[model samples]
Target: MAVHHETAEELVEEVFLFGRALKLAVGNSDSSLLPPALTGVLGMLSIHGECRQTELASLLCLSQSALSRQLSDLVEWGYITRTPDPDDRRAALVRVSDSGFEILERIKESRVARLSTMLGEWSEEQALAALESVRHLKDTFTDQARHASADYTLIAR
Candidate 1:
């Protein structure tokens, strides 16, 4: 139990360092790239497919007005498209555009290449262990998020 507590603390510290390194890498990359705000909007759209503006705003924790501004920027950047909701012509549903998907692919490739370069000196065993650890951590967080949402729903009711 003591060992687990110490390991968790160390893992948290390392995760903060990893986040700083990632932010630095992203900031040093192409200026034309999407900012984090825009990335979040696009990422949610990509994950949820198409969703109404109100629903998207709620998911993003942004007010409808704030989301409107971001959505306008996304549309202007050719990263996303808004279409009239078939169910209710008064509302619009948003989704990533084809060009946006291409850009996303490029961004993904760049990050993968960067990570590969950074890991170049690592032994195969070390790299595999790190990968497995990250995968487990991600799964744990995902499960917790789901559980929290379920709990919130129950509380709200």
Candidate 2:
């Protein structure tokens, strides 16, 4: 079926609205856990294994001090660890600890179950297609943001 042009914007808005709703639902489900930013940091650590604080701050779009506070909190909670960097003694590398990975795994399971329930009515093919489209859209948005940043730098000079 051909999608109406006017409905395109509505579709985008609905996607964002649903995303917000999902986030709210997940946040409400777990009260004692870390905030979303900390959760994101843990997830990033899970994927990247270990990384420098500066790199993590850049990846997370947070100021160094802000990231430091979050990392400190995680360390205090025993969800992450900071060790002296092997390559640079002056620098520290942060990694998600075993406990952190356990928490992250639980979060992943909860998210998957919740999303599965929400999309239970959807056919597997339809859901996979939608997932692929969303992935592409995210990548495209990232690329556009990078280009815009480059343009801004040029204009600033």
Superposition error at 49 for model 2 (Å): 2.7
lDDT of 2 by residue, 1-157 (tens): 9879889889889879978997787755543566777898888878888999999988788899998998998999999999999999999999999999999888777777777887889999999898898899789879999999899999999
Clashes of each: 0, 0
Once model 2 is optimally superposed onto the true structure by TM-score, how far is the C-alpha of residue 137 displaced, in angstroms?
0.6
Clashing residue pairs in candidate 2, if any?
Answer: none
Give each prediction's root-mean-square deviation over alpha carbons.
2.5, 3.4
Over 48-99, each residue of candidate 1 has an lDDT whose tens digit, in order, gives 8889989899888899999999999999989999899999999988999998
Ten contiguous residues with the weakest lDDT in model 1: 26-35
For candidate 2, the per-residue lDDT at 41 reads: 84
- The CA lDDT at 106 in model 1 is 74
Model 1 clash pairs are none
